[model samples]
Target: MKYVVVIGDGMVDLPLKELDGKTPLQQAKTPNMDFIAKNGSCGMLQTVPPGMAPGSDVANLSIMGYDPKKYYTGRGPLEAASIGAELSDDDVGFRCNFITEDEGRLDDFNAGHISTAEASQLIEALNQHFYRYGKFYLGTSYRHLFVYKKKDAATLESTPPHDVVGEPITEHLLKPENDPLAIKLNELMYKTSKILEKHPVNQKRLDKGKKLANMIWLWGQGTKPQMPPFVDTYGIKGATITGVDLIKGIGTYLGLTNVHVPGATGYYDTDYCGKVNFALEALQDHDLVFIHVEAPDEAGHAGDIQEKILAIERIDRRILGKLLEELPSLGDYAIAILPDHPTPIDVRTHTSDPIPYAMYSPGCESDKTEAYNESSVENSFKNSSKELMEGYKFLKFFIDYSQCKKA
Candidate 1:
């Protein structure tokens, strides 16, 4: 089995923020990441198309070589698969977000930051009410990824009402502009909210003096993923190390095993050292290990450039640096570092610009002089594969082509 370790911020950004001064990456002191770049072959990656929503869910799919256009059914259902919610062929999956509803309008997206347990309980109650025919899965944080299986493919979709947070909940599902199924979804959203307002979970939280889980935001409707398992693609049994349910959900959906480790948090301050070791361990059992460091992206989204740098540096010093030092002793392992996409702190969203990436061996060396900007690694890369390619192209990066039969 061959080993390839992909490490970096895994989010393709939308050009939401204007380029004013030096980008956040340009300003950070990430010696470790810089070390990896100088020691490896560098290049760029575009994980999403222009003008599409800036979501890592789709972008990560692209990086794994799954074309978003072909595989993205919607964000929620893909996540639903990871949570073990079986969806029907016809049933659509929608990403359900927990939000606050004030006078029928989306007030805030996170529903007062309702605790994950509260979120899970609220979903259970919603399922108890509507799951008579379909499926509902509540995950960590205030996310509910759902699947409506065998319902007949339909063209209906909805997300949290945009922008204005404190207005009356809008009738997103019932609009005539959408397919009749969307109208049904809207009806379902309204009913779901009403039931949630009094859900036993919400009631329990409220009774316990906690915030009530009140509303839902939905987006990204998708069918199940249709691809060979990673093992089939690269001869390495696939395993993943992730703390966030979103990434975990991706692994679960893609038929990869989740290697859970103690002290791993799926948040900005997620343990870097712990995450790195987890990936290294997976290498013993499998050939490909997708190690995700989500903090830099999170810091950028928060628009805190300083925090973003710190997050970047933290991973570099703690994770990438150590990996580089141990390469010689690790035998035949290959390491590649690249951002999934641009998550710039300046605008607090994803960007469309090409991200700088580099692949390095144990003792290779180079002369890139920048820390984290895309410019540093541009010279190292030669071929630009437009967007992302799944399986075949991704696998070729690993096993020598001589190992494969002609197509």
Candidate 2:
């Protein structure tokens, strides 16, 4: 049987008063998602385990059937794998983001979504200056990787830039100020600001009234991860289609094919149709294909309610809608739709909330879910015997639910 998992990254949200007290999922038209809920089963999935930060790395790892608590090393190592940056046992890979620092505060996490072309030049300059400490590898846009040789650097507590937007950079820099590694890294961050401030890239960005990627924030550090191949764990060859390097990195470690689509930008303008088309092709050889979209998550980070709604609609129409139309031809397919975590509009960051999921396979018993939304799934959970399933368990449940019904 063909399996398709469409992950609308950070697609779920809390009810917003501006959207008439309805969450984005409820406000957006998602007939394709609703159809799955109506014809199959719906329930909540706790993608983030207890006491863990609700980052995409942890959440998606859980969704891919690896318990985050057991397998998750850090976000940096994952992106490092995606960029082909091999991490030695003593090397700590860090997620280096080019962010906007204004008046000693973290102004923007993404620096106005800097272009990859501009970011490449900055990455070169970083390598030139910081070769003694580590080397920086360009990934996409503001996202990059830095591999530090000292394994102790991984123990330094560093905060995610997105989580401390508009906060003092000093307040959020690598913690335990007495630690030599933290002091050194924090100094490197300050030095980075001096180099980026005078760079031609920043000058050009200032001229264009765009946010300057004026400093690098390093966090999410870890050594290489030891993960069993996807086939070994699930007995299915899987592939991944995503614009984000983190997702690609996860797939790389899992032995899943990272299908490259030219138009998948990991932004608001990301090609939704292109991702689905690539996934469909990958399915010709793969047992399961994961289609992950980042636009909705980007909108959530920006707190753009309308854009989030638009992204949700685009996923429903351009991705899920098309999948529903074409998957019938592929035969005996089970398709599932869900978000990795909730990037709530009000909170504007990843939350440890149990996101909703809906899955459909031909002849599977339905739970009588009226629609695919937060409210509907909450109601379904209240009425049904199914507790909120762990994120890692959802994959197995999705794979076996249909077979058990047919039996």
| RMSD to the hidden true structure, all candidates | 4.7, 0.8
Stretches off by above 4 angstroms in model 1 are: 1-4, 7-20, 49-54, 102-107, 149-154, 160-178, 198-212, 363-369, 378-395, 398-407
Worst 10 residues of 2 by lDDT: 398-407
Residue-wise lDDT of candidate 2 within 1-407, one digit each (tens)?
Answer: 89999999999999899988899999999999999999999999999999999999999999999999999989999999999999889989999999999999999999999999999999999899989988999999999999999998888888989999999888898989989999999999999988998999999999999999999999998889999999998999999999999999999999999999998999999999999999999999999999999989999999999999999999999999999999989978999999999999888999998999999997888997999999998898899998889999999999997675469
- Per-residue CA lDDT of candidate 1, range 1-407, in tens? 33555545633233333434555565556676666566654555556656556477767776665666766666766677667777667667777777777666666565655777767777777888887546677676766776766344334544433333555566454334456565556667777778888777777766777655576666667676666566665555777776666677677766788888665555566788887788777777676677777777766555665666677667777777777665446566666666666765545556556666655555444445344456555543543332333322443553342232222
Each prediction's total of clashing residue pairs, residues at least 3 apart in sequence or on different chains, is: 28, 0
Task: Please give the lDDT score at residue 394 for candidate 2.
Answer: 95
Error of model 2, residue 200, in angstroms: 0.9
- TM-score of each candidate? 0.81, 0.99
lDDT of 1 at 249: 69
Candidate 2 residue pairs in clash (backbone atoms < 3 Å): none
